[model samples]
Target: MSEGLSTRILDHIVHLSPPGTLEDSADAFRKLGFTVTPGGTHADGQTANALIIFADGTYLELLHFTHAPPASTAHPWAHKPPGWIDYAFLGNAGTPSVADTINRRAAADGSGVRYAPEVRGGRTRADDGRVLEWLITAPAPSEGNGTRASARGRLPFFCGDVTPREWRVPLEPRSNAEHASKARGVAYVKLLVLPSELDAYAKELTSVLGVSPAASSASQVVWELERQPSDSQPYQAPTLVLNAAEEYEEEIYVRERGAGIYELGVAVEDAGKAGVAYTPYGRVVWQAIGSR
Candidate 1:
């Protein structure tokens, strides 16, 4: 467990589009009032994601396959792991031993999910010779009941080494930008419920994200943005909840394949204005969800 990555809080979450094609979904996101950036092929050469920037260092990444099916040998996350998505937390110099610390914390929480966290980090130099560093994976099980961090694990904690001061720059884009998405930034995200696992899922998230779960009525839990760390003024790590009832099985299955939303949120400045762009999917409104 090395220190030096950022884990300030969740800066963003990711949604993996279907493998090999996301133009439609990308367009859909664009219509949702976001400035969608281009994505490139992964190092393992399996998928890609268009990123949505927030004023905060955090952003939302929509990943999907970009070419021929990736060989099984590619990175598990890049192979397009199953689930609605993945999320990125802040990491910086203060977060050394992040992998180890979180694993230990989880186990101490007494949820009984045991596993150790592994790392896939490397160092590369910037043009000026400064080393750009990054590392990620689930918190080690020792920190969280010794559970293994597997591909598509629910609410896996993301620890970062980057400090709040150093994140003023924009994230790198994977592809090109279209004019339509220029004004876009993350407004917030909504997690449609995983009710069957709501309590357990919320508990896991609290451990990983360092935030308590919100109470629910009708299985719909909404997290309101409190501190807008970014220019968009959206809360950091703001999450939305939907009823994940067995009653809604078909809808969940259609969206998740077999699982539920790894995470869900949105990018917009004015929910009212953005509603027009979102009408095709469902009713759009600046629905008020209280702060936690």
Candidate 2:
């Protein structure tokens, strides 16, 4: 495997809800046995969120618009209907930024991958009046001026924090990481791509992750993640799975939301609680994978 980008650690996955449903969404997740933490409004003031943090440091961000939708169709969340909208990889602002590193690798390999310039973003904590900031870099349109790629959510965006990451993702009070449903952390994320686009997306993801797929077939590609060790229990490394949207449900999903993350798999401990659950925000497919 190529030494992937240093910033490839899974950060968090975003679950978007309809306008003004932040609190409702949070409450719904709590009922599902998660511990939801209050996340204040974004610097933009139009969005706010709550977080369901996991033992392994990855989290589920339950978010919603605070007011009317932005008028611009170019906005990431503009016209986006509630569901799993995006996911992020931890990143940094350094000599060779995450975006620069990935783009450089793509250039070297003749893969035309381009991430937009990093944008500054932050939010205040609702529990405490603290401010946290970060830089975001997402896939951008390739002008065809390059070697050969283009797409979105099929790959993760990068989020590099300006403030202490702990302040932004507090893992203290161990109970916060303990869910009644026994979910330990993200197990895998599955994206549904049009059959014709699978090959291109596989290349796009390989370029972004800086590593080749651990397993692949004509219909699916899998990249196994090396997870951060948990304090309470050892975890099986997570996996990122991309496959063609040929099933009826998958086809419908692509028609409705295009190619993007449609489901999340979380590692859980209780067999009784192991199953699938659909929420207004997103679909969760969990399993009873005991500690390693």
Candidate 3:
């Protein structure tokens, strides 16, 4: 494996809800000016999802199970709560794969960030019969010891497409990406963690993403994605922010749901025009493009 892994782009964020709430979740996002496309059931036949694709190749997945899986199933969603439960980063196609590098670096750093071996994952489009396939590297299962486990839901997994990327993300009739709210793409994803766990989680994330923390403080730590500066293009890749939950005014989700995704920052042409609304899942913050 290379001393350091190649940069991994943000692929998508997963928003999980209870069964039979898929349509309502789509409707809620549609009301917020996103174009929600119909997603089909997972290959496991346990869950279904709807996708909100952005122009930047990043997307938001609204997932819910068609019916609960058997009690013996060990999928992550089987016991997760209703909210932004997980997220994934794009991975390379060859060996020592991105997952390998992540686990390797985590082991070297002693950050306790490890993932299960890559596995095949796929789904058939509900609108059409087309099939989509990919390889996923999920967090390794916990050993019931006091040691921190990646399966607790703080770290992101990796996804590498077996089929062409464009096939999974179609680009046709620009209208598919357009929205009523003038929203463009994801700006950043904010995660909440207890102040005590901030340093450990930051180290774990740094090792997993193969990126260094840009800024850190008692309140929060920020990791900005690496992107070349350009005069022609102003929008940069999305960022990942880990905030201390105790600093917040209201209830911190981490208190209820462990360390996990808390808020989604979306980029819009005009924040004023993009009205703020709370969904059954979580909060969405609309910000003007290029704003910090």
Candidate 4:
């Protein structure tokens, strides 16, 4: 039996693509005008990722498996095609053990319906002498069985490091000179649930994330998650909301495609500059960005 999930702060959301290349993802974001910074690659030689930085130290990641397993006949990611893959949150510094704690808890909850958590970490140099350490709860190569993506709602992973540098490389501070912009932070992560399975899906998130049951809403159900940035200290708190509904048109297309990030919620200072800058990409999500 497994216990419960232990997670920290909300860091970023991840989108997985396989046959779709990282270059394509980068191109798409480039069309949108946000600076997509280079990020790390998985050790399995099967993945790579890029990041869209925001002011709050929170960002969005686009991931794709560059090299599929040698013997893999059907890439799991193929089933889903292209869209959101998985998302992760940042962790606290001191007593950085959220990964272990989460794995332990999940193992105690229920094995039949729960998946075992494996920890991943190593020395990855992000800046000169600036080593970035991270941890994730994931299935091993053998466990994944060479498959890539699945709608099982992959486990939530947390990241913490010994030396927590708030910002080693400032993510190009807001500049009105070229394009004035600001970070409003993420509003919510929207997901789709079949009319019949809405309740079950909501319960699953609450159980797996240790979040209390939702208060209740007619349009969408929200789950609140609080995170302690550090093991020994407490400070500002932010919440992540998971919304599900059967009537969302966007959800209809994304659901048919597979369960993945279809859209994002971002607040910017100058929707006009953002609109002008992101004009290359199909169009800005914010209505103002396009017109302004």
Q: Please give each candidate's TM-score.
A: 0.64, 0.91, 0.90, 0.65
Lowest summed lDDT window (length 10), candidate 4: 275-284
Which candidate, 1 or 2, would have the higher lDDT against the true structure? 2
lDDT of each: 0.46, 0.81, 0.77, 0.48
Quote model 4's TM-score: 0.65
Residue 63 lDDT in candidate 2: 87
Error of 3 at 67 (Å): 1.3
Supply the global lDDT for candidate 4.
0.48
Per-residue CA lDDT of candidate 4, range 1-292, in tens?
1233345356777665554377787777665555666665545445666767655556666777666545544433434445655556654452434545544444565422243344445333333334454445442222346663343333345554434434322344443112223444444455555545555555545545655555656445565555433222122233444455445675675466543344455545555533222322211243222231
| Candidates 3 and 4 compared by lDDT, better number | 3
List residue ranges in candidate 2 displaced over 4 A.
1-5, 143-152, 229-233, 290-292
Candidate 1 is scored at a TM of 0.64
Per TM-score, the best of the predicted structures is: 2
Give the clashing pairs for model 3. none
For model 3, how does the per-residue alpha-carbon lDDT over 1-292 read when each residue is reduced to its tens digit? 3754454467788998888789989998898778987778889888999888776667788999887666787677777888788988776454667767778888889998777788888888898878889888777865657763446457887777887765566544467667787777778888888888889989988887777888888888999864211112257678899988875542356777888888888888875755455778788888788677
By TM-score, the candidates rank as 2, 3, 4, 1
Q: Report the C-alpha displacement of residue 170, candidate 4, in angstroms.
A: 6.7
> Residue-wise lDDT of candidate 1 within 130-198, one digit each (tens)?
333344555332333575334343444453434232322244442322224333333344444445666
Candidate 1 segments exceeding 4 Å error = 1-8, 22-25, 78-83, 93-95, 113-118, 121-133, 139-153, 157-188, 192-194, 214-237, 240-243, 246-259, 274-292
lDDT tens string, model 2, 1-292?
Answer: 2344465578889998888888889888988889998888899888898999998888888888887785863557656778898889887754356777788878887777878778899999999989999988888865556643335565788887799877888888878788988888888888888999898878878888888899999889998765643334565767889989978989999888878798899898886677799886588987778632
